[model samples]
Target: MGKIVLSTNVTLDGVVQDPDGQEGFELGGWFHQFVGSGDLEAWTAAETEEAQGAEALLLGRRSYEWFASRTPSMADRVSSTWADSMNSLPKYVVSSTLDHPRWRNTTVLNGDAAKEISELKRKVDGQILVYGSYQLVRTLIDHNLADELRLVVFPVVLGTGLRLFGETCRRKPLRLVDTRRVGDGLVSHAYEFVSVNPV
Candidate 1:
């Protein structure tokens, strides 16, 4: 079975809102503040490594639109190697409204989200990285579909914003499998979902 890995960048407070300040959120751009503060090269290398390791990408409708609109080629702002990996990877988007996706090697899952994703996990091989899909991540957690979480935590507290876990999220157990420091304060935590009913 393929592993569903949620890989996302968030603030120390778990805020996943606009990190690039493009969304006009009051507490936006927390991610950019770490540019010169820490070891940027190390962070970039870490991100690139993750992108290269991922076999495919899974995203929600909004995240797909956001990334498509911002970085069409997936190259401009990101490293060429990382961008290349991202552009070449097979992408699956869970959406009820999207009729056609412009991104290459893309598939739209418009049916029942949980069932489609579960089937996807069974079909696909290797790691399927889920990025910046808040609602989808919650659904995965709620349904016990997510197998692992790789969170790159930035050192900042955005007080209030769209957090990773909302009120709709249910209780789920996670076991910390790995932890790595990217830069000065950026810490990456990899947690494996602990199955309540083990098979």
Candidate 2:
């Protein structure tokens, strides 16, 4: 069975919005803030390692479009290696409206999202990576479909933004599998969701 691994970069305050400053958020570019501060290289290496280890990519419609739009320009960037791994991996996107995906080796899951994802978990072996799909991640966690979380935490408090976990999210316990510093200021934490039977 394939494990659903939700991977993302987040601030110390748990904000996951616009890390690269691409979406024009007010406190965007928290990722780039560590570039010259001796963290970017290590962070990039860690991200690359994660990407290379993933068996497949799962994303939401907006994130799929975002990555597709940036794919052409990613070849020459510092993230080129990671981008290469992403582009080469099989991609699954959950969207009712997306009829055709421009990204190569892409599958559009237009049917019931939860059902399709559940079926996918049974069919695919190894890890199925989810990145920046906030809504999708919430749905997985709420439905008890997500298996693990790989968070690369940056040392910054934005005070407010789109957080990874929302207020109405149900209580789910997680077991810390690993925690380590990626760079001078960045920390990587891995957590697995613990199964709990209700009374």
Query: Which predicted model would earn the best TM-score?
Result: 2
> What's the distance in Å from true for residue 4, model 2?
0.4
Candidate 1's displacement at residue 129, Å, is 0.4
> Runs in model 2 with CA error above 4 Å?
35-37
| Per-residue lDDT value at 191 in model 2 | 99
Q: All candidates' lDDT scores?
A: 0.86, 0.90
Return the number of clashes found in candidate 2: 0
Clashes found in each candidate (C-alpha, N, C closer than 3 A): 0, 0
lDDT of 2 by residue, 1-199 (tens): 9999999999888999999898989989888885444688788788788889988999999999998888757878767898899889999999999998999989999999999999999989989999999999999999999999999888889998999998545689999999998867888999999998987
Candidate 1's C-alpha runs over 4 A off are 72-76
